[model samples]
Target chain A: MTEPSAKRGIAVEQAVVYGLLTALGLFAFVVALGYGLFLDEFRVGPGLVPAVVGGLITLIAGWELVATLRGQRTPHDKGLAEIVAAAAEAPPGGVSSDDDLPGGTLPSGEQAGEGTSDGVDIFGRTAAMRGRQLVIVFVALTVSVLLVPLLGFLGSFFLLSLFISAAVERRSWISATIVSFAAVAVIYLVFVVFLRVPLPAGLIGIGG
Target chain B: MLDNLVLGFSTALTPENLLWCFVGVLIGTVVGVLPGLGSTTGVAVLLPLTLSLEPVTGLIMLAGIYYGSQYGGTITSVLISTPGEASSVVTTLDGYQMARQGRAGAALAISAIGSFVAAIISLGLLVALAPPFARFALDFGPPEMLAVMILGLATIVSFAGDNRALGLLMALTGLLISTVGVEPGSGTSRFTFHSIYLLGGVPFVEVMIGLFAVGEVLYQIREGAAAPIRAGFRELLISKADLKRSAAPILRGSFLGFLFGILPGAGSTLASFMAYGIEKRVSKRGHEFGTGAIEGVAAPESANNAAANANFVPTLTLGIPGGATTAVLLGAFMINGIQPGPLLFDEQPALVWGLLASFFIGNVILLVLNLPLAPVFAQILRVPYGYMYPMILLTSLVGAYSISNSMYSVWVVLIFGIIGYFMKRLDLPMAPLVLGLVLGPLFEKALVQTSAIGDGNIGIVFTRPLALAVMALAIIQIVAPSLMARLLRRRNSSRARKADQAAEDKTEEHSHG
Candidate 1:
């Protein structure tokens, strides 16, 4: 009974994706057209390939959008039946759950539906947890990058690894600290000492 | 040839080269066993480190990593039902089932042994054929090169996944992305948007790290925890009957995989799939394919390894990469100012021969490393995601930063990581995209060169017999997959309709009775 709605949802999602891709293609096409098709002496200009590629992309994306609107399933949707069949044949207790299955959930977690604060549902909990972890990790990486100029490579790396492990992943602080330090030290030695990479050194600067 | 081989052995047998080979394979094995990271990511992440080393030694190490990961990929597939590499996807069908039935050791052992045997066979073929192939390719002009590139792209697009259009789209997108910097011939600014960083172009290695490593880490984290399987040392041994049963499949898979691998863009993943499919059709116990069939495990494992070695053929001889890992290796070659082509053998015999000889040594190292450590490697599954994912993120970030020592590259990694995540969600194949990005500049150059050579005549491509033949092949490749799929679907539907009609007739008879 819910199959139709699921199909519609996927179609809508695909349409949106294709629409965005078409827009990107159109933008690139316009920009590339401005760059001109030929330079001096009949030589092909920089814009030629990009323009053609952009045009192709626009055409393909438009076709995809129309297909989606016409209720055609994306290639991924067609593969789901195979996946389901394979999952069914999987050994007893081989899979932890359907949620853990590869390609099971949408990246946005929209397919899993909404999550409650209590987190009773396994799928909801997993989606919510994953979303939180992804954000945390992303932020951690961004902060680490920002910190590299101020704190130097080793200092920033140590802090980044520690924060991600201890705070984000929720590992024990002691172990995180140990692992972070060890990892940073090894990287420092390898890049700076042995390979002679001349990594950036900021406030606590020791010139390579 | 023999003298060159002796020289190769002399260079490869050096302590420095041997050590690097071991390190490369070791790192490859670890990354390969990890669920998210594959040989592509492994080679990309480690590439910057190799930049400081001698070109020959670095390449030998990189080559080791390339094939070593094939052996490592089997470990996860056999033990966990998770394929560590895309090529290992088929291995999970019967391998995980065998693991569930308490034969994890046997599965792991057979996979390692099969991979080793296939590696040896493929390596021998590579040595025998690569020089002649390169010599033949030396005759190829711009039109022929373009045709070959087109063929490669077509094969990848056709075989990428269920969606041919999506694959083509991704490949086109990659080509578009590659056009972001300065134009090669005209010295004109491209889609740089006036930024200095953009002027230099997007760093390929950073993009690779972001897409494969960071994107993969995010996916794994989202997957949460999976149930871990434990395999003891006792389970590592395969029975003599098991070996006898696997022997034919291994040999068949090796040859099939090698053939597929030598073709441009049809990589180890396709080779493994084809091997599994062929094995199912040919084996006596074919009906029991997805249910703990030893041949199922042996075929794909052996095939992937063979394909991994065979990939070097095109990469070295034609300067064309068969897959993503080889694309990175191609980048590595360029980074070292060593252009890989027909001229490479003549220009740098030591580097070429030494790298080949190292493959022989590296395969031996991998066989030794994988067999005894299969059970030990399985224990890596016991490591909590919490500990592992954070370290992966750290490595990715550091790897990205270290590449150019620029914060911009780090940002590139982060951005591409997100893009990769979304691409995965949308079920876009990443390989075609990477291939396009890597091959885009070369494709463009070939196109321009062909145009100039032909005096702007579009029909000149048809004039060259070799180019015409390749184009014909490309067209067939593009048409064949869909044609086969349609036929298969029609056959299945007709059979189902017949079954339904028979059931209805039976019901009518019962009602009359």
Candidate 2:
């Protein structure tokens, strides 16, 4: 009836989430307090504000956890079901409690009014795991960012473009080459040469 | 007055702005074709590329993206039932159905035509009426401004997912987040924590990229990918009848969009939502709304585009931003030593008029491009999940990094991406969260400034007639929908029970016979 591949829904899970937030808040408060210390002699220093913010975020996260554990449901949802519903967050249709269902989650490929006994897939632990696929793409992007200054905009753009088409878009080498080249040439011609917005070039950069 | 705007035809007609506008629309169209991405993010990502350009050209490009994306959003909504933004959520009802019924082509054509028609009408309205409207809005004091902000509050209930408080909580979080670096009024470092990066408050673009783009990527990765779809080109056009039926909805939505566009802070999403709601109430067969009505797509698509251009009024004339895109545009204006205000019309007549003129030109061009290229764009709907998942993640991070060039921003992008992922899983409305975060500072700025003027009088929200009226309206906007839904559910429930009983009797009679 509910999502808990690891375990059933429990207050401890909610408490743990909240407690971590509170700990974070406390850490922030300590950081802020440290900022007030001037060479070991404490006076009002710069950390006062950050301390407060971190403290607040922590507190809010904590309070939310506490509320969840107590079964005092929030105006927002936090459970696995809530996450799944929120993913696609569609309006309910044909279901008995469609209107009241907190519906935001990763859109499971369920057509409206279609659900299977296997499990409601709008969200599940599987979606959370699949999130790692995002990391590979980001890593490729970071490398591209560093390369832009090193190899020059056109050069870096070419390499990055190819990498992305192949790595991300999953195109064939020949296709990635054709598309990347075309895309870069267009960007270079329009943005760099035509429009005259200075793009990064390794040691030969302009646009100050 | 029309002539003055037409005077801008010379500057806008320059081959340069026209070309960029085309580019902008193309990029926007591409972005919109992708599911889980929308206009605001498109504008935000593109803004940096335009910083070095003349303000007007950059703004024209941004405007193109704004409306162009709405046109593109419909293509996906109809074909795949995915709404990249909340404004098009209603479109999925009829759009996907039409696709299923093999009328995908019709849905695409009608939505595009409807959007173009509405956009042109709105552009005409904007050119003819915006300046005078601005002059009137210039007179809005703190109370009146408060009223406008309060009116924005009304969106919370409609947007507030299952629990209104959650929306408020998110809004409060946004408010706090906005107040991160320096307390503008007090000049106190309220939350920076002595970090040099914190000296400047969180950048709106960075936050938007994190919340919308990155967050969406995380969610997409988790859900996995849709099965491969191979739609042939022949499957994408509408019959003449579809166009005829959608025409009235397009007109109604356009008018609604224009009116909403005229209002400060009431952005495209609200305009579309309202248009859809009205279409539902007035439809001869309102009961068919969810099951699949072309009216769903027609109404919202028209309204979003109409509201999109209309939103430019506050951004340009009053030096006030009505929504996220406008706020970014305001940044562009400030960067170029041009303050967008009443004086702007007098000082930079060419810039203003040219921008207005380009809107018309852009809409026409976009229509031409979309009508012919609908099938090509629809092909984007078929890209496999394995390819799409990794690509979405890549673009999101790169976009985030480009916004701020900082690891912390990247971290925030990841964090929010995760939050978005989890939020999607739980069924919490991300629209309200994004809206709140984007508008929170504006709301707070207005509230604080208004109260400051009232000199600690809490009743000023109601005591001031303008503020009072708007406040009351806001309250109703929030409370009314939920109440109506409750009443509707009751009616639906009772009706269903009665129908079931009648069916039971008929079954009994048939058996007896």
Candidate 3:
């Protein structure tokens, strides 16, 4: 009932996971070896637990590798398959430009599952936009963090929120701008004014 | 006991404590109603704010959040079929069906009432048992403590998921990471790699936020949004008949949950699942379980709440956290310079009694708040995921940064968030990892102390009768689940073979005729 290629693919993925785990275990073991297992006073030293833990990791990871090589399936393998399948079924190129248009009707929270019927190609879209979106979001957050020393907490947070709304959620320019500033104001009022946290003040340093 | 209760009530009744309790429950409910945000995340994110308050007040607020979130998770399960917490997953099997059948009101009301009843029952048990349990734990020395911790670890690893090996590996990884800081005994850093920031160790709170909150947001984004069902205020009330029908299951679930909750690593999620399974087997209307039976909604909801309350027994007595949220609470205890163990009951009787009294008050507040607000909270599901996720991200980032006011902590959160996403995709359990991280220092200290006490003898644990017994139990705990699974598999295979043989024989007879 199952294709050989699919089975081979799963085997390959399992091997990769096991191999990575084994590498991590070995690395931890090597690092732990730098410390003494037991001191001269016969008391357990800094590395005792780490050594034991690292050894156990290596043992378990090796077992997992052997099991996978023997054509056995693991829960990790099954979970990975599900993730891959879901990603393959998602809409291509993320949400389209038309959906991002100012007057476009946003789907209700209930219609979230009826994504396929919203007119997207099924094949060649298996590569999910999720990876791209995550990278984008991560980059935005990193930039915001870097900007905090220059722009201050309020300014950095505002810019971050605006980017998320406009670039990620693809909201209209006016709504994104309004929501971003409002959200920043609320955050500043609660975290700085009320909680009295000393948020960083950069160029537009208003509150400390 | 009477005097303790008086002291507890007087303390819990204060205006400041009461206000904080109310705030905690309110926030707990909101976060719990939002899918992908569980009590573990809620407690971790808010823990920093509590650092500024008195220890007793902070603890009361945390406890309120713990139980209130259980009640909140039921709302989403019944209304939208989306379980806001892992413990609520079983509730959705029937709760969502009830929503589809227009009995959403009855389901929601029963869940709330059941949760309230369970909380009171479990709180009674906690008060009655915790003191005695703490007294008993007073006899535990280094070796005994080590045995107990091993038993706890074994229980968690066995029950973590279908693959025991993966769970154990994750827990070991957590322990390894925990060893990165300066060793207390030797004063030498184990795996800091010469970094100054690493001397203080990996921040557990930041890891919790990253793993639970940020990781969940990423997973949700990938899954895409689903439409949540709408409910009106009229549908929030239940008939008397519904209450009558649910009473027995509620009581049964409470007892079962309390029993499970006392066990190390047997958390609310497991308790709820077990309660649902037992209800399906024992209830008169069991056959209709998955099709929106009121008893189904009542049982797991009650069980989870009871389990949440009962988790405090081990946490406050033996200093062993029952699950992830309790682990965070243990960290809170340490942050406030309060060590939770046998000594705690004697050292801080007022604090202990006050916390016990606040549980009752908090449950009452939750009942009054939830009964009228279930519909209101359900309306939160209608909020677009697009708007919600960015806020969640911001909260996680800020929560991590606020802990130590260090950008390094924020970076730790981001790194762990990616790791958590991969772990989820890989089907590795997170709770056991958290348990391992929290317990690592204690476990190592116990191990070292026991060795010194026994003059470096490795068999010191076997010399003590109680420690030996606990070690034996730990071994049994590790072996039992897998053994049972194998036995069940064999029986199922035999049954399948017999059925196939019978069908083959019937076909041959028909052909011959």
Please give the CA lDDT of all the candidate structures.
Answer: 0.78, 0.63, 0.77
Between candidates 1 and 2, name the one with more favorable TM-score. 1
Model 1: iRMSD? 7.1
Mind giving the per-residue lDDT tens digits that candidate 1 earns over B63-168?
Answer: 8888888888788777766676778877877887788778888899899899989998998999999999889999999889899889888877876655778989
- C-alpha displacement of A150 in model 2, angstroms? 8.5
- Comparing 1 and 2 by DockQ, which wins? 1
Question: Model 2 residue B129 lDDT?
Answer: 78
**Interface RMSD of structure candidate 3 (Å):** 11.8
Ranking by DockQ: 1, 3, 2
* TM-score of each predicted structure versus truth: 0.89, 0.76, 0.87
Candidate 3 local lDDT, A1-208, one digit each (tens): 0556645765776677777878878887877778887766666767778888998888998888888898887644212112212222122222222222111111111122333322222221221465467677877877887887888766787888899999888899899999888877776766666666667777777444
Preferred candidate (DockQ higher): 1 or 3: 1
Weakest lDDT window of 10 consecutive positions for candidate 1 chain B:
B225-234
| Selected candidate, larger lDDT, 1 vs 2 | 1
List model 2 lDDT by residue over A1-208, tens digit each: 2445422333454456456656766776675565452212222234533455456666677767777766674544232212222221222222223342211222322222112212323223243344444566556555765666567655665676688678655679998888777766766665656656455567645221
TM for candidate 2 is: 0.76
